[model samples]
Target chain A: MKPVATIEGRAIPLGLKNLDTDVIIPAHWLKTITRDGLGKGAFETLRAEPGNILDDPEYAGAPILIAGDNFGCGSSREHAAWALADLGIAAVIAPSFSDIFSGNAFKNGILTVALPQEAVDRLLEVARDHPVTVDLDSQTVTTPFQDRFAFAIDPFRKHCLSEGLDEIGLTLASSAAIGAFERMEGRPWLVPSASPANVGLNGTIA
Target chain B: MASRPRTLYEKIWDAHVVERREDGTCLLYIDRHLVHEVTSPQAFEGLRVAGRRVRRPELTLAVPDHNVPTTARLGADGTPLPIADPESAAQLAALTRNTAEFGIPYIPATAPAQGIVHVVGPEQGFSLPGATVVCGDSHTAAHGGIGALAFGIGTSEVEHVLATQTLLLAGSKTMEVRVEGDLGPGITAKDLILHIIGRIGTAGGTGHVIEYRGRVFEEMSVEGRLTVCNMSIEGGARAGLIAPDETVFAWLEGRPMAPAGEAWDAALAWWRTLATDPGARFDKSVVIDAAEVEPTVTWGTSPEDVAGIGGHVPDPDSFADPAKQAAAAKSLAYMGLAPGTPLSDIPVENVFIGSCTNSRIEDLRAAAAVLDGRTKAPGVKWAIAVPGSGLVKRQAEAEGLDRIFTAAGFEWREPGCSACLAMNPDKVPAGERCASTSNRNFVGRQGPGARTHLMSPAMAAAAAVTGRLTDVRALMAS
Candidate 1:
C-alpha cells in the first residue's frame, strides 16, 4: 500500500444507480487467481455499449469516478473494488455505498466519498468537460470550474489512507500489545476436528 | 440511574477485542473463517505471492457452492455433476487445489453435507457461540443466528484473516430489534425479516450490528433463526444475532464439528452465560408485532422495495422526498410493474426455490407442503427446487419430497446454489420474471435482464402453482 494525498485527473462520469459488483466485474471474469488483468474486465457489460464512458477515450485512465447513488450495492466480492483500482480509479464519488462495498473499497486504498445527489449531479456535468480533483487531506472534490464540494470520511480511515497502513501493517505496529494479550489464560479458539487432543473426526491435525 | 448494562453485542465484542488503539481501530481474534469458490481464489493467490502461510488453517474452512451445477448429471460411474461452464469449473477447481495446498479443511461439492458456506458452518458447528467469524460472502451473517459475532468481509480481509487469524476492525454501533407476540401459523421467518427491512429501508442497519431479541425470536425454530439471520446483510447490517440458549445447544449437540462429552458440557456452560443482561442498553431499538406481519415479497430490485403479496406496487408520488420518489419510480419501471397494479396479478414465468436464504430441509418441506396436491398454473414455464446441499437433496428424496415436487411439475434436482445466482448454468432467461426465495433481488441477479421478485419458499411455490405472486397464507387457507 502507498500513501495518497490527492488524485487529479479526468473523471469518468458513470452515474448509474445500484451499480453492483457484478456489473463492475462479471462473475465469469472472477475465475482468475491473480488480480492482474482485471482492468480489462471492469465494467465488461457497460464497456460493450456504444459511447460507453469506460470506452470513451476522453476519460481514459482517469483516476476519479463519479457514480450514482448506491454504488457497489451487491455482493461482497472485493473484486469490484480491485477492478476499479486496476482501472486506475483512485476515488469514487457516490451518493451512498453499501456497507460491505465501502469497507472493501477502503481496505483496497480506494477512497469513497458520499455527497448529496445534487452535488454529484453537478460533478457529473463538470467532469465531462474538464478534470476534477479529490483531495483526501482536505476532504473536498474540486473541479477546475471552481465547483468545490466537501465530503466526510471517518478520521481513522482518512489516517489509514494517508499512511498506507493495511490491516497487517497495523497488526505489526501493535505486535507488542498483541503478544501481551495472547499471554492471557485463553487459547485461540480451535475446531474439535483439529484440536490438539486426540479427536474423533481425524486422528489429529493440530 | 447510572446507566443501562452492556448489551450482548458489547459483551461479545469486548471479549474479542485483543487490542484497542487510539486510531479508532482494534484487533479482534477471528475464531473461524469460511471461504467459498467464488471469492477466495484471489485471496489465496495473494498469500502465495507474498510467501505467507495460513496462520491457523484449522480455523478456516472452504467449500464449493456458488458455481457448481444443481442437477446431478454424474459421469457414467456416478461422480460430481459435469461442470458446464469453464469459468465455474475453474473457480471450483482453484478452490479445491488452494484449500489442499493451504492445509485447510475443505468440504467439496461431492461431500454429502457440503452446501452453501453460510448453511454448512453453523449446522456443522464450525461456527459457535461467542466466536468471531468472517467469510468473503455477505450472507455469512447467517452464522450470527447461533450467537456468534459473524459477518462478511472482502477478499482482502479474507486474506488478512488467513495470514493473521485476526482482523483490524472498527467498532460497530449496536441496535436491538424487539419482536413480541406469536407469529401467525402461516407466517415464516422470511416474512418477518422482509417486513422489518420494508419498514426500515435497505440502509437502515448501516454501521450497526443488530441483536434480534424478544419472545418471537426466542421461541423461533433454529432453522427459522438461520433464515432471519441470513437476510441480515440485506438490511445492510454488519451482522444480526440471537442469544444462545437450550435450542441452539440442542441443535449443535452431535454435529461433527462440535466438541464432545466433557468438552461439550464445558462449552454449553459458557454458552449459557452469553445472553444480554436484562438492563442492557442499545444505541437504537425498534419494536414490532410479529403477528402484524404478512406474507411479504420484494416487488423491485432493492430488498427494501417490498410489500405484502396482496398489496400493490407503491406509487412514487407517495414518497415526499425527491430522491426516494425517483428511486421508487425507477424501481417500478425497471421491474416492469405498473403503479396501483395488484401484486397478486403480476404474472410469473419462473419460480425458483433454492438459495442460501431458503434451501435447507425446513424450507424444502414448506414448499413441498404447498405443492403436495396441486400442479403449477397453466402459464408457468419453469419451476424447480434446487436443494442447498447433497445431504439436503438425499434427505428430500428419503422423505419423497422430490416426488411431490416433481408431481407438481417442479424440477427437483441436486444441490449447489442453482437459481439464486447466474454464476452457474441454471438461470432465468432475459426479459422474464422469476419468483425466487434468494436473499437478493438485484436487477439481472438471476440472469441478464431477468427480473427477480424476492419472497419466501411458500410464496415461490404458490407463485408456481398460481402463475402469479399469490399470497401463501391465502393459499393455505383456501
Candidate 2:
C-alpha cells in the first residue's frame, strides 16, 4: 500500500469499451470473501480463449493495462480491483472509469490513469513494442522512445496513497481530534447533535 | 430562514439525516444492514484492524446466495460437489464466523430457509417501510418493494454502516411513475418494467429516485413489485420505491420478523403514511397503459434496445441521432439481427429463467404455466430454471413445479445466481445465444461470445420450448 512512486511496465492492451466489473472478475468470483486466489479467476472466460492477452506469453507479467473507454462499469465490486492487483496490473490507462470503480481501485492502491484519447492511442501503439513508465512523483507516463505524457490524480487520493492511509487509517490518525470531540460531549458547546434523533444516534458510541 | 414545506421524501430524508458536512453530503442513519456471504469479508477485516464491534448488531442480517451451486450434484469422482469452488466456501465460512462473532443473524447456505437476501428480507418481514436499509449487494434495492429508503452500498459503505449505521448521500430527485388499467392476461410485471424501460430509455432516471405508483402497482403482489423494482438499476435509477399499503402490511403481517399484535398495528400506522401526498410534487412524471404492455423482450445488447416480441428490430438509420444510430447498428450486428428482422426468428442455444430479478415462486409458476406438458427444443445446449431462494426452491418442489420443469427437459436447480452472468460452471459456450430472465444482455455477459436476449420468465420458457426467441404471446394464444 505504499505510495506508488513510479510504475514501469508493459501494457497489455484490452481494447474494449464499457468493460464492466462482471467482465473484469465476474459476479461468481465475488462469492469468495477473501481477496486471495482471485487472479486465477480474473477474466477466466477470456483466459479460456487460446490467445487471450492474459494467456499470451508475449504479455506475460505486464504491469499496465490500456483499456478502452468507459472501463470498469457495473456493480461496484472491489474485488475487481483486487483481481487486477493480484494479476500484477499496477496501473490502468483508460479514457474514463466508472466513478465507483475508480474509487475502489484508488483505495486498493491501484493507479487509474485517465488520459486523452490521442495519448491513449499513442501509448497503445508504443505498448505493442516496448514497456511504458508511469512516475507518480512526476505525474508522468514515459515511453522508451523518450516521449512523456503528464497526468493527474485527485490530490486527496494522492495524499492517501502517499501516506498509505485508508478511510479508517485517516480516521484513526485523527484519534486525538476525535478524543477532543468526545470530551465536548455533555458540554453546552462545540458541535451539539444536529437533530433530536442524533441526540441518541449520532456518534454517541453507546 | 427559508420555510418551504417538506415533501414525503424530504421528511423521510430529513428523519434519517444523522450528520451533514460542508460538502453537501448527508450522513444518513441506516437502520437495517443486510449482508450476503459475498461482500462482507473485507468490511469485517476493516473492523478487526480498527478493533471495533458492529455498532448495532440487532439491525443487521446475513445470508448466502451468489456462490451456492444449484445443479452440480457431485464431483467427477462421484463425491458430492464440496461447495464447487473453494472461494465461495471460504466466503460462506467467513460470514458464519463474522455473524457468530457479532451476534448477528445469519441464514446459512445449507439452511432450508436460505435464499437471496432481497427475497428473504421482505418475505421474513425484516425490511419495513420508512426505514433505511443497506445491503452490500447492489440488488438490495429489492427491499424498496416495501417503501423503504433502500440502497445498495459498496463494501466500504458496508463497513461504514456496520461501524456507524449511516452512509453519505447526495440525496436524489423524486419521479412518480403512474400505471393505470389492468395488465393483459399474458403480460407480467417483467413485461411492465420492460415497457417502462423501453419508453424511458436507459439513463432516463439518472440522479433520480423513482416511486412506482398507481392502481397497477397498488394491486401488485409483493413479488411483482420486487420484480419491477429489481431492475431499477437497469433503468439507471438510483433506487425504486413503492409506498406501503394494506397489501404491504398484509404481506408482512405474519412473517418471522414482523411485529406481532400491537407493535404490528403501530408499524402499519406509520407505514401507511410513507406514501406521497395528493399534492406532492415530483421532479418528473411518466404514465403508462398497463394493458398495452405485452410479453416484452430485448433483442439487442442494452436493456433499452429492446422491443416487444414479434416486432421488428428497429432500423438505425430511422433514428435522427447519430450516437443512437451507431449504438443500434452495433447491437444489431453483434446480435446477428438485422433491421426489420422479426425478433421471433432469432434462434437461441440456451434458455435461463432464474436470478435475483425473476426467480421467485411467482416467476416459477408463471414459467410453469407456459411449459405445462411441453418439452424443450432439440439440441439446445442448456435450458434451466433456477429459483431465487431456498423457500422458492422448496415451494416449487412441493407444488410439483420442479417435476413440470424436469418433464419439459429443463434443469431445475438449487437457488443461486445461475447462468445470470454464467460466472460459475453454468455458462452458454462461446457464440451461443440464450433467452435469459436475468437483467443485462451486454456482450459476453453470460459468457465469452455468449449472446443473451433478456425476456420474461414465460418468454424464456417459450424460447426454451421453441429453440428460438419466439413471442410468448403467440405461444400463450396458441
Candidate 3:
C-alpha cells in the first residue's frame, strides 16, 4: 500500500452511472496470479469505443476520475481498484459507491470521495479543461475555478490511507484480544477439526 | 435497567467484536473463510512474502470453481486431465499449493465436494448459524441464508483474515425488508428478489445489511433463501441475512462439517436466539406485498432494469432522470432491445441454468421439471444445465433430473461456475443473447459482447424450449 495525501491532475470524466467491476476489468483479465500489468486491460470494453474518454489522450494517466452515482456497483472484485491504480488514478469522485468497492479502494490506497450529484456534475465539467485537486488532509476536492467540495470518510480509514498502514499487521497486534474472544466464546464447533478422517470418501461426513 | 433490544445483525456484531477502536471500527473475528481460485492466489502470495502463517488453517476451506471446466476432468485411466486454459490451470494450481503450504483444507478440483465457494460452504456445513463467514468472492452472502454473517472481501482483506482471523471493520446499519402475504403460485424466490431489486434500485441497500423478514422468507426453502441472499450484492448490499429457524436447523443436521450430538444441541439452543428482538428497530424498513411480485426478467444490463414478463421494452426517453435515461439508452444499445417490443418476443440463442445464484439441487429440479417432455426450440442453438456441486449433480442424476434435461435437448454437465461469468470455455458467442439464471446481466458478463437476460431457472428453461423470453407460468399451463 502507498500513502495517499494529495493528488492533483486532469481527471477522467467518466460520468456513466452503474459502472460495474466488469467494465473496470473483465473476468478474462482475472486469470493472472499476480496483480501487475492490469492497466492494459483496465476499461478494456469502454476503451474499445473510438471516442471513449478513458482512451482520450487529454485524460491519459489522469490522477482523478469523476464518475456518476453507484460507481463500482457490482462484484466484490479488488481487481477493479487495482486496475484503477494501474491506470494512475489516485481518487474517484462519485455521488455514491458500493460498500465493498469503497472498502477495496481504501485498502489499495485509492481514495473514494462521495460528493453530491451536483458537485460531481460541476467537477465533471471543470475536469474536462483543468486539473483537479483532491487533498485527503483537508477532506476536500477542489478545482482551480475556486470550486471546493467537502467529503466525509471514516476516520480509521483516513488514518490508514494517510499512513499506508498494513491492516493485517495492525490486526495482528490485537492477537491477544482475538484469542481472548475465542476463549470466551468457547464454541469449538466454530473451528471444527479438519483432520482427513472427518472427510469421507465422497467428501461428505463419514 | 433494561438491556437494549438488538436486531439479529447487532447481536452477531456484538458477539464477534474482538476489540473496538475509538473511531468506531472494530477488529471483528471471523469464524469461517472460504477461498476459490481466482481471487485468492495473490492473497496467499502476500502471506508468503510477509512470512505469515494462517492463524487458524482449520477454519479455512479452498476449492476451484471459477475457471474449472464443466466437461470431463479425467481420462480413460481415471487420472485427472489438464485444464484446457493454461492461465486458469495455473491459477487453480496456485490455490492447491497455497492451501497445502498454509495447512488449509482444500477440496481438489476433481473432488466430489468441489463447486462454487458459496455453495460448497453451506453444503459442507462449514457455514453455520451465528458464524462470521468471509470469502474472496462476492456471492459469499449466500451463506447468510443459513444465519451466518457472511460477505465478500478483496484480496487484501482475504489475506488479513487468513493471517489474523479478524477484520478491521465498522458495523453496518440494519435494514429490514418485510414481505407479507403468500407468494402467488408459480412465483419463486428469484422472482421475489428481482421484484425487490426493481422496487429499490441497484444502490438501494448500500451501506446496510438487509434482513429478509416476513412469512414469504420464513417459509422459503433453505436453498431458496440462499438464492435470494446470493444476489444481495447485485442490489449493492454486502450481505443479506434471513433469521435461522427450525428450517435451517433441520437442513443443517448431520452435514459433514456441522456439529454433532451435544454440540448440535448446544448450537441449536444458541441459534434459536439469533433473531431480531420484538422491540428492536432498524435504520430503514421497506414493507412489500408478496402478491405484487410477478415472474420477472431484467430487460437491460442492470439488475434493476426489470419488469414483469408481460411488459414491453422501456423507452429510455420515458425515464424522468436524465442520468437514468442515458443509462437506459446505453443498456438498450448494448442489449440490442427495441423500445415497445414485448419482452416475451425477445429471442435468445443460448440458455444457461447455473451460477452461484441458481445452481443448487432445487434450482436444477425446477429447471428439469420445465424441460421434461420439452425439447429446445430450433432457434435456441445451445442449452446447458450445470449443477452447483458434484453432490448436486449426483443427486439430480439419482432423481433422473439429468436424463430429463438431456432428453429435452439441454446438455447435462458436471458442476462448476460454467457460463456464469464465461471464465471457462462455456461462453455464449459474442453478439448472441442468452436467457441465463446467473445473477448479473452486466454487459459482456457472459462473454465479450455477449448479452444476458437474467431470470429464474424455470424461466430460462422456458426460454430454451420456446427460443424466446417465455414466462414459466405460461409454459407450465401449456
Highest lDDT model number: 3
TM-score of chain B of 1: 0.97
**Tens digit of per-residue lDDT, candidate 2, span B76-154:** 8866466757766677678888888876667766565667778777766667777777787656767777777776667
Q: Order of all candidates by lDDT, from best down to worst?
A: 3, 1, 2
Q: How well does chain B match by TM-score in each candidate? A: 0.97, 0.94, 0.99
User: Which residue pairs clash in candidate 3?
Assistant: none
Kindly report which residue pairs in candidate 1 clash with one another.
none
Over B175-231, each residue of candidate 3 has an lDDT whose tens digit, in order, gives 889999989989999999999999878999999999999998889999999999998
- Interface root mean square deviation of every model, in Å? 4.3, 9.8, 2.4
Docking quality (DockQ) for each candidate: 0.39, 0.14, 0.58
Q: What would the TM-scores of all predictions be?
A: 0.93, 0.80, 0.98
| Comparison by lDDT, 1 against 2, better one | 1
Residue B34's C-alpha lDDT in candidate 1?
A: 89
Candidate 1, B1-478: lDDT as tens digits: 2245777777777877778778767788788888898888988898898788887788788878888887665667876565777777888789889987998877777666677888777766778887888999888888888888889999988988898888888888988888989888888999999999887677778788989998888888888888898888787788999998899989887766777776777677777877998887788888888878989988887888888877898899998767678777877877898889999989999999989889889999999999999999988899989887666787889999999999999998777778887888889888789999998887667887788999999999999999999988878888
Q: Relative to the true structure, how large is the alpha-carbon lDDT of every model?
A: 0.83, 0.75, 0.90
